[model samples]
Target: MPEPIPSFAALGSHPLHPMLIHFPVAALLGLVASDLGYVLSGDPFWARAGLWLAGVGAFGGWLASGLGLIDLIAVRRIRCLMTAWCHAVLAMMMLSLASLNWLQRYLAAEPILPWGLYLSLLTALLILLTAWLGSRLVYEHAVGVEAKE
Candidate 1:
């Protein structure tokens, strides 16, 4: 068997990228639900929730991606994998969408209907795709897995 590729952006033994990804994933996905809640109930509360979620998701995603980028750049084995490149590209695309979504909500006082919802949905989809590619790196290629001695 091939040796596992350890995470260069790790904190001690734990991989920082994986550890930090859950928050952004949950927050970004929740933005869709919050937007839907605003649509269904016509409450400004949901819209406000969406704004917070978007900001948190976009910021947190970038933070995690930064660590992952470090690992991808610093480790030759990770850099050589096509899955790594795909994951990186998709992650960047997703982050861009997320940032745009946040910016729109931040700058606009109008309702978050139509366009915001669309952006949220697109960002969520990209997040899923990026996550799948990232999972393949960890599960299939063992990109951040450490072998037991």
Candidate 2:
């Protein structure tokens, strides 16, 4: 079996992935709500808010993914390696979607574009699946968690 990852990537023995994940998760999920608000109220504020949230969420996702990469390397020998790859791929996809959403919003002349709103809603669904895979990595597969002595 491969050796475990060093403790540096963790926070006092806890996984960094879990700790840093909240920001992107919240930001991305919040995007759907904000987009919904724009859709229902036709308010530009919600669109602007969604744009900012998308940027923040994409950035935060990459940051978290960097730490997750470390964990992935550490757990390469585990049986759930394929699941990890799926998680990583979906995460990067989610980030790409969010980044593109932000770009569309930033470049558009209109207050809110229908395609951008629809894309964000799709991104929200991807976030849900990606988050579920992350949870599976920790709970079912014990990817980043240290074994109990």
Candidate 3:
């Protein structure tokens, strides 16, 4: 069976997942820093900044996930399909945390409490782990590289 056009397309020579993933990873990590700033300084500015970061991270994550899904679906014969699935699940979990964190702040008017801080920290860790898995797909499994003739 043939893969769909969107699944196989790339931006220039690079796959979209690699290109689009950095934004959400960076934004999610930034959200953790902003959470710390708000907690230590008790400034609403940091809280507001965290809110914005969460929203941006969620948006970027959605975009990246779309690309990742396409790639995952297209490459059915890859060696590290399990790792890719794990990465996808963890990425979605982290994105969900970011979205929920933002919703708590924006919609429910919740403060940057200890629980929220802990969740942000956890999300940061998940991003790191998920990134490692993604790297494994490239470095260990060679999922996206063109095969040498």
Candidate 4:
């Protein structure tokens, strides 16, 4: 078996990128739910909730991505993995969509309509794809996994 790749962007032995990713993933996925809630119930509360979720998701995703990028750049073994590249690309796409979604809601007086909902849905889908690729890196390639003695 190949040797494990350690995370350069780590707090001691814990990878910062993986640790920080969960909040943004949850927030982005929750944004879709909020959008659907608004669509079904026509509630302004859901729209407002979606606004916060999008903002948090986009911002938090960037922060986590930065750490991941650091590891990708610093670790030659990680850079050699196709799964890491795909995960990075998909994550960038998802973050872009999330930023646009948040911007739409922030600028428009009445948000969470056809465009906001659509963007939310698209971003959510990308999140799933990106997450899958990331999981493959960890579980299959053992990126960031420490070797046992």
Clashing pairs in 4: none
Tell me the TM-score of each prediction against the true structure.
0.97, 0.86, 0.87, 0.97
Could you give candidate 4's per-residue lDDT for residues 6-71 as a string of tens digits? 999998878999999999999999998999999999998999899999999999999999999999
Report residue 72 deviation for candidate 3 (angstroms): 0.8
- Model 2: how large is the Cα RMSD against the reference? 3.0
Which order, best to worst by TM-score? 1, 4, 3, 2
Model 4 segments beyond 4 Å from truth?
none
lDDT of 1 by residue, 91-138 (tens): 999999899999999999864888899999999999889999988998
Model 3 CA deviation exceeding 4 Å by range: 1-9, 147-149
For candidate 2, write residues 73-146 as lDDT tens digits. 66545434787789989988888988888788888886356777777888889988998987776677655667
User: Residue 26 in candidate 1 has what lDDT?
Assistant: 98
Q: What are the runs in model 1 whose C-alpha is more than 4 Å off?
A: none
- Superposed model 2: Cα runs more than 4 Å off: 1-8, 78-80
lDDT of 3 by residue, 3-50 (tens): 212335477656787788888888889988999899899889998898
